[model samples]
Target chain A: MLEVRGIQTFYGNIQALKSVSLSIREGEIVTLIGANGAGKSTTLMSICGVTPPRHGEILFRGQPIHRLGAEKIVTLGICQVPEGRHIFPQMSVLENLEMGAYLRQDKAAIKADVDEVFERFPILGKRRQQAGGTLSGGEQQMLAISRALLARPTLLLLDEPSLGLAPLIIKQIFEIIRKINAESNTTVFLVEQNANQALKIAHRGYVMENGAITLEDRADNLLSNEEVKKAYLGI
Target chain B: MDSEYFFELLCGGLVKGSIYALIALGYTMVYGIIQLINFAHGEIYMIGAFVAFIVSGVLTLTGYGGPTVLLLAAVIAIIYAAAYGYTLEKIAYRPLRAAPRLSPLISAIGASIFLTNYVQLAQTPDFLPFPELITDFDFMEPFSRYVSSVDLVILVVTTLTMIALTVLIKYTRVGKAMRATQQDAVMARLVGINVDRVISATFIIGSALAAIAGVLIASRTGQINSAIGFMAGIKAFTAAVLGGIGNIPGAVLGGLVLGIAETLGAGYISSAYEDVFAFGLLVLILVLRPAGLLGKAVKQKV
Candidate 1:
C-alpha cells in the first residue's frame, strides 16, 4: 500500500532520481533492480523521507508521506532496513531489536513481536546478549532484518540485505523474507543488485536506470527477458 | 617537607582533585555520547553552589539546625541545579542535535556566558560566602594534621558520586541507550531510541555532578563568585583532556593527577603559574599517549 509518481531527488547539484514512479500493493514483495548509481537507493530514501523528492508525490496507505520527517514516516508503519546493516555496533543484539519498537507503546505487543523475530531467526535468540558489531556479515544482515521486523512495519523497505553476505546466508535471508511476507502479510519493497534472487520472490518488479523506471513486468516474465538477461543476469 | 606535612598536602590535593573529577565527569559524559564539550557545564556548577548558598542563608534565617541541616539543604540545592542542567540541555542543546558540532559548541559557550551573567545579576560579582557546615569538627586536627573536615567531606562525597555514576552507566537501560546512541545515532533512531531523550538525560546527569562539585568547592574555600567556574572549568577541562576527552575513568585519573601536580607546583614554585603546570601536564600527556593512562587508543581506520 505505497504509491510513488514522478519524483525527482538530488544530492546537492547532482540529480539522483529523475522522474521515477513505481507502486507496491498490499501484502506483496516488490523489487527495484539496478546497477550502481541507478537511483534505486535514492528511490527508497525518497519514499521514506530521508531525502524528500524535490518534485513528486509519495503516498503511504493514502496518506502523503513525502513531506514527513524520517522519524514520522516510521510512525506511519513504513520502516527501512538501510544499506550496510547500520547496526548500533556497541549495543547487544537484543538492544538493537528493542530500538526497532522505540515508538510503540503497549509493552505486551512489543514483547510478542520481539519473540516472533527471535523465532524467525533462531540464531539471534542464542546470541541476543552479544554486541551487534561482533556479528559476522551474514549474522549482522539477519540482525538488521530482525531489527526492522521489531518495528512491526506495514511496509518494510530493505536496501540490499545480501550485500557482503555469503551465498548460503543470502538464500536464508530470502527464505525468511518469503516467510515474513507469507505469515505477517507485510508489504515489502526491496532494492537489490542480485537480479535473479530478487526476481524469484518479487511478485512484480521494476528495472531502474539512471533514476528512471525503464522496465516494469511480472517477476517471471522479466526473469526470462533477453534484454534483462544481457544487462542484469549476464547470461 | 616532613612525611606528615607531605601526607597533609597529599590529602589536600586529593580533596581538590575530587572536585575536578566531579566536574570533569560532566564534561566527559557529554563528550562521550553527543561528542559535545558542554562548555556550559561549569556554569551549571556555579549555579548549583549559588543555589546552595542562597538556600543555606534562608535556612539559617529560619533557624534550621547546624551542619546536618546544611547538608540536607545542599542536597536539595543539587536537585534544583540538576533541574537547571536538564532544562539547559532541553532548551539549548537538544535543538542543535542535528546541527553541526560547532553549532552546539557555540551554543554551549553562549549558554555559559548567559548563565554567568544571570547569576552575576542575581547574586553578586564579588565572592559570596559558602555556609560553614562543619568547620568546628576539624577531623585531621587530632593527628596534628593540616587537613580539615571540609577536605574529608569533599573526598568522601566525590568518591561516592563517582562510584554511583559508574554503576548507573554500567548497569542501567538508559546507559545502554546512551552507548547505543553514541555508537550510531542513525541506527539508534531506527530502533526507537528517542535519541533526544537519552541525550537530555545525559546532560542532566552531568550537570548534577558538576553542581555537587561546585557546592563542595564553595564550602571548602569559604567563598565563590560568578567567575569561580571559569578557573575550575578550565582545570577540569584540562583534566578531561589529559584523561582522554571521552573516556570516563580517564577523567577521574586525569583530574587527580592534575590536582596533585598543580598543588605540588604551587607549593614548591610560584602560585601564580599554578595553572600553567596543570595545563602543561595535560599537553604533555596528550602528546605522549594521546589516550591517557587508562584509555585505549583506538587505531583509526585508514
Candidate 2:
C-alpha cells in the first residue's frame, strides 16, 4: 500500500502538482485518469523520487520513502516504467531485463523471474538477443513492462503504457496488466489518458485536472457518472 | 623511403599512439557518461607523471634503482591518480549534475586551470628529467635497430591495458550498469543502479589509465613540465572527437590514426605542419561521415 499526502511539486516557477493526495490499497489496480499536463506523471515521479515533492510526504507500507533517492526507492520495491518507454537503446533485451533485477542478490530467483516474464510475453522471448531499441513501439512497451516486472516490485507504477501503441497492442498490454495483478498480486498505480479502458480494469479511479484530484470513486460508478461520461468518456 | 626506415617510423608512431590512446579513453568515457569534456583529464595525467617523479626521487634517495623500482613507481602513480580522479569528480563535477550543460563544462575548464597552476606552484615550472628506467635492458639489442626496449615496454603495457579495459567494460556487471547509465540515466536509476557511483568509478578508472600514459610519455621524452598537459589534452580531445566522442573503441582508433598521420606527416613533409595534417584528416572524416570511423549514427526515437 502507498499513501501520498499534500504533495506539491514544481518545475522552476511553475507548479506541476498542487498539494495532491491519493492512496492505493494492497493488490488493487488504481488508475489516475487525466488530460494533458494534469500531473499524473508528476505524481508517479514524485513517489519514485525523480522529482521529489517540494512539500509532502509519501509513505510506502507505512514507511516514509519521499526523502529517499530514486535508486533507493527502487530497492524499497517501488518501480516505475517511465513515460516514453525509456529502454536501454543499445543493450539487448536480455540485458535490459537483467538491469531490472539490479539490486537483487538472489541469482536463482532473478533467473526464474526473467523466465516468467518471457513466458508471459512470448514475443519478447523470441527477440531476447535483439537490441531493445530495434523493437516496435508495442514490443518496446512490453519490454518496458517486462523489465519492470523483473524487478519483482511489490508496487508497480506504469506511466502511459498505451501512449503510442495500436489499439490491438493496447488491448494485449492491458490484458497482461490485468493478468499481472491477478496472478502476481502486484499493486499497480497506473496513470493514463485513456479513461474508459483504464476505469474498466481499475478497482478504484481518480480523475485529475489542473494538478488536483477532482474526483474519486469506484470504477463502475465513475464509468457511468454523467459528468465523467460527458467530459472524459466522450459519450 | 626504405622498408627499414618505414618499419622504424611505424614503431615510433605506435609508441606515441599508445600514449594518446590511453589519454583519449579518459576523455571519451567521461564524455559518454556525463556529456562533459573533462578538460582537466590532461592535468590528471600530468599529476601522474609528477607523482612518478616524486616516487622515483624518494626511491633513489633510498638507493633503490632497477626495473622493479620503476614498476613500483608506475603502480603508485596509478593509485594516486585514481584518488585525484575521485576527488576531482566529487569536487568539480558532482555539484553540477543537474545544472545546465555549460556549467559542468566551465567547471571542467576551471579545474584544468587550477590543476596546471597547482602543479606549477607545488613543483618547479621548468621541465624535470624523467629517470631512464629501461636503458639497462640490452635484451632488445636484436630489434634495437627498429625499436628500443622502452618502446617495446610501452607497446606491451598499452596492449595489455587495452585488453583489460575492454574486458572490464564488455563482460562485467558494473560495465553493464555503465552502459545502461550511458543510454538512460533515469531508467538506470529505476533499475536500482547507483548512477553517481558508476560515474565516479568511470573517473577513477579513466584517470588511472591516463596516469600510466603520462609515465610512458615522460619515459619516452625524458622530460616533463607543468604546462605539458594543455597541448596533450587538446590533442587527445581531438582524438576522442575524431573517433566518435562517445564510442570507446573509436577513441583508440582515433588516437592511433592521429599518431600515425602526424608522425608520417612530420617525416615526409614539413615537420612544423604536422598538426595541420592531423586536423585536416579530422575535417575530412567529419565532412564525409560526421560520425567518427567506428561510431555508429544513432537515430533518436520519439
Best by TM-score: 2
How close to the true structure is residue A26 of candidate 1, measured as C-alpha lDDT?
A: 97
Q: Give, for candidate 2 chain A, the lowest lDDT window spanning 10 residues.
A: A113-122
Candidate no. 1 TM-score:
0.86
C-alpha displacement of B115 in model 2, angstroms?
A: 0.8
Model 1 lDDT tens row, A1-235 = 8889899998877999989988999999999999999999889878877788999899877888899777788888888898998887766888788777777777799889888878877888888998777788888888888888878888999999888788998999999888889889999998999999999999999999998999999999999999999999889
lDDT agreement of model 1 with the native: 0.84
User: For model 1, what is the error of residue A118's alpha carbon versus the real structure, in angstroms, after optimal superposition?
Assistant: 5.3
Best candidate (score: lDDT): 2
Question: Please, what are the lDDT tens digits per residue for candidate 2 over residues A83-138?
Answer: 99999988888999998988888999998988887887888899999888888999
Residue-pair clashes, model 1: 4
Tens digits of per-residue lDDT, candidate 2, B175-271, equal 8888999999888988888999999999999999999999888888899999988888988888888999989999999999888888888877878
Give lDDT tens digits, candidate 1, residues B1-302: 67876676677778878899999988988898888888888888888888888888888888875776668767877898789888988888888877878999999899989999999997799987777876656446795366677777788888899889988876676776777777777766655566778888888788889888988898888898998877888889888888888888889998999888888787778779888988889888988988776665432111
lDDT of 2: 0.90
TM-score of chain A of each: 0.97, 0.98
Q: What local lDDT does model 2 show for residue B181?
A: 91
What level of docking quality does candidate 1 show?
acceptable
